[model samples]
Target: MTADGPADLSGLKIDRDAPPPETGRLRRVLLWGAVTVLALGGAVLAYRAANPASVPVAVARAEPLGGVPGAGATEILTANGYVVARQRASVSTEVAGRLNQLFVEEGSRVRKGQVLGVLQNADQKSALASAHAALASAEAREAEAAANARETSLARGRAQQLHAKGLVSQAELDQAVASDDVARARVKSAEAEVRSTAARVESAQVDYDKTFIRAPFAGAVLRKEAEVGEIVSPIPSSGGLTRGAIVTMANLATLEVEADVNEGYVSRVHEGMRAEITLDAYPDERFPGHVRQIVPTADRQKATVLVKVAFDRLDARVLPEMGIKTSFLADSPATGSAAGTTAVAAAVAIPKRAVREADGRAVVYVVEGGRAVMRGVSPRPLAGDRVAVSAGLAPGELVIVEAPSTLGDKSRVRVK
Candidate 1:
């Protein structure tokens, strides 16, 4: 209601298009902040790409310590080895021949003296038959010779009686006695012939039996080297077609781990020392064992000694020639408890750097699915470099060593 014509509103409504100074300043500040944030984010990404966090794998694992299979064992030494049978044999024919039949296959369980395969033995059978006939003929001749001797003795007696009664001359009685002596000598020769024939028969029978391949001991068949119609020989043949063995069988009951230990470290191992065996096929399973024997000889080229370790108990999954790893345990003397039982504390010794103290408890970072997972463990002071964990951890689990401060539970990590 200004009567000075709606135009006298001077100085109040002059700049309708100009932006406020404070608003512009505020926008500039926000723009710069956003740019700074983007720049910092890009820098962080580049840094991460160049330098990724890495963690070393922990070597500690729960395993059998001694005597019996249990957890929390300390591994003193580790070696790669193979499962071997103490009583392994390659069954073959004594004489070279074409295999006629096979009685066993791979993984077949057999007993000692059980026939595993048979070779073609028609010729051997025929020879044995001939020997039997010859033996029979010789026996018949021996009987005939004995009958002649009896007749000759009777005649000699008759002649002697006649001579004593002066019914015959001395020359006649002498001739009869000489004839009896000849017959007795013939009988002895026939008996010798019969024995010789019987021996020949026995030899023939042996030859026939040699065609059958028998297991040397109770074991499991690992491989079949020969098939029907294939030639098998006890000795290696010059040709490739002939098989040197019929079947390769091993006494599974005698399964043991054969590890090649470094000559320098062999001194630390001895017979009856407790050991833990792990097969590649069954990595999580631990088999308690003991040192069976150390080979007297060392490999000159490898500079290693062969050590055989026997299982505390056998498992059906343990087979000959399987890849395995062995851990030799330090000997811990058994102590008698108040209950009159042996009390032994089996503890897993891990590198001290791998363990972290959190919330006044021992914690270890284990790798699972490419992530670091924390596990609480009961720890005790072991040696200078290690801590003994009495609980919480399993054999063959990958643990992160010297975990980074940034590592948290379920954090993504790369193990080196």
Candidate 2:
């Protein structure tokens, strides 16, 4: 076996010149294709980052000015304000005590004299019971005194007759007459005590009634200020352990807009002026309104006059404290009829930021079908941070506010 043991070992060696197996070649091609595809995908993502398909933008709707949008009335003034309830109150108990029960919650509609809550009245109940017992005892004493007085009267009469017949001594007759007088006095004293006890019972009843917290007027409860087991008081406590109000309620029927008009322009608005109101919560809705009152006083610090505007017809959607924009309409022939007092003009306004300057021309990026469309606008400066658009936009159309410089026509957008 000696010299031939490793014979023909060279023939078993691999041929580097030969092509790889079909499976190996297929796997290598696939790996290279995957790497190339991944590289292309990375490059595409980088390009997209530099040039976004859509832009993030702040937007505001083109709102009407002066009155209901497109109502075609002259707008005398524009003011921003909040809805307020003229008749609002924070109801509380007359006496301070731990809250025992609650019959209402936030948004609960309650009627006048309806029990809203109750305070722990165990002590008050005990006092009332005691007063009733005292009254009963006093009344019983009065009855006893009356009986004794009758008996004494009879005895006195008998003694008088006896004295007249000379059957009894003068001393015995005098004693009987004195007894009658004493008994009558006792009856009078007992009557006074009974009256005093009755008054005490009434006092106790008043104290007991105070434990129930009742609504002062019919209204919607805006907030439940006190919870069960919390101490409530008529007066606010400095220590903060007691709540000063059980609930805060407002008369929704008395909902009105309280706007502050610039003193410089106050003359343009007056009581009974026709107006249009748009609430921030319901921006698309135009509510007919009138100037209910022009507050006689002016705010010295703000240089503004408070104006109260009342809705011509109340809506269920209207709520207290909602932000609102009001257009005070000037008297015009269109609104001359008594029923046309709520007429408004056809004018539009938008936030000042919504209008942009492009090539010395005013432009705005209006959103349509999720795309920005640049349009020219004719803007007139208004009293506040708003501009009246005489052209190029319609009420309820959304325009990009403070749009980025990179944003262009036909750029996709998503409302924030």
Candidate 3:
């Protein structure tokens, strides 16, 4: 039976497994899935690293329109100019002399008639003293002449009385009268000498006072042109070490802007015209001003007229010769008769270039913490290249001007 069973089993075929284990199949699928996912993640990281979302743009600060006088006024013309003080002067001595003492320095506030410098007055002082002595001597000589004239007249009267009593001859009376006349003439000559000396004393005093340099007006000293021991003169010197002025000063209260208007636009400007002044040093600050004067002359070469504009209220920030830009406005009686008196509608204004159209809406990219935040704004037209944002912006916010096409909400930006 065992031999027959073995022979039959050898003829029969055995059942074998045709598919791999289910666990092995599942493991292979998962390994490929992980590799694909890792590859995709790496690709994403590489793309992001190579291309950043940051954009470069120019930026401008949103400013309040109310603070800018004549912002709403119709600007007829614009011009560039310089700030100048109407009462500016270079203080110098009336007479040339070496400076002995300097009482003021640059930036020193001086009052009218205050001594700014004292010239070497040793010679002047000696001359003044000599003058005073001469005056005193003249006065004493005048008294002496009066006393001598009186005494001679009395002696002549006594001689006349004796001659009338027949105690003397007619010749003696004549002689007495001649003696009195001579004495009187001598007294007159002495009086003339006294008057001449007195005039000389006065002239000397005036010359002495000329040595002290005094401020002509109340102002701040802008420059110290002469130092102690330096020669200062009324006239400029080209020969030696002499300065024409001891100090240059200006009245800060009289600060004004002198702008040159193109001859074509000169008709738009007139005396008392309201203007908005912006200083180059303080671009954001606008000052209210009025046309003070139109210089009668014009520059033929530049074809420009010089217009002087005075500030409504002088500020300490304003200085002489500072560069400024001015906007001359058309008459707006409803706004106000004078500049800085009008109450304008409060709005935040930015450069027109800062605004962009996004999806049929006006948008501005505001920069905050180096990131651009998109804001929907309702814009209105403003003077010049400015847009007044009536609905959406606040004053002092930075808006991106010349925004790049790729700029988006919360995009990183580098302000140029």
Write the residue-wise lDDT of candidate 1 on 1-416 in tens digits. 56755665566777879887699889999999999999999999999876665554433454323332233244678888999888888888899999999999898999999999899999999999999999999999999999999999999999999999999999999999999999999999999999999999999999999998899899899998888999888887787878999899988888889999999899999998888787898776566689989999999999999999998768777777899989898755567778886746554656667788789988998788877788999765432355556667655676677545777887767655
Q: Write one digit per residue (lDDT tens) for candidate 2, span 331-382.
A: 4445466665643345677888888788999999999988899999877654
Model 1's alpha-carbon lDDT is 0.82
Best by lDDT: 2
* Candidate 1 error regions (>4 Å): 1-73, 331-416
Poorest stretch of ten by lDDT in candidate 2: 64-73
CA lDDT, every model vs. true structure: 0.82, 0.87, 0.83
Candidate 2, superposed: residue stretches over 4 Å from native: 1-72, 333-416
lDDT of 3 by residue, 200-317 (tens): 8888889888987889999999999988988888897788578999889999988889999999889888898878788998786667678989999889999999999988767777
Best by TM-score: 1
Q: Give per-model TM-scores.
A: 0.64, 0.63, 0.62
| CA displacement after TM-score superposition, residue 386 of candidate 1 (Å) | 28
Give the lowest summed-lDDT range of ten residues in model 3.
64-73
lDDT order, best first, reads 2, 3, 1
The per-residue C-alpha lDDT of model 1 at residue 54 equals: 55
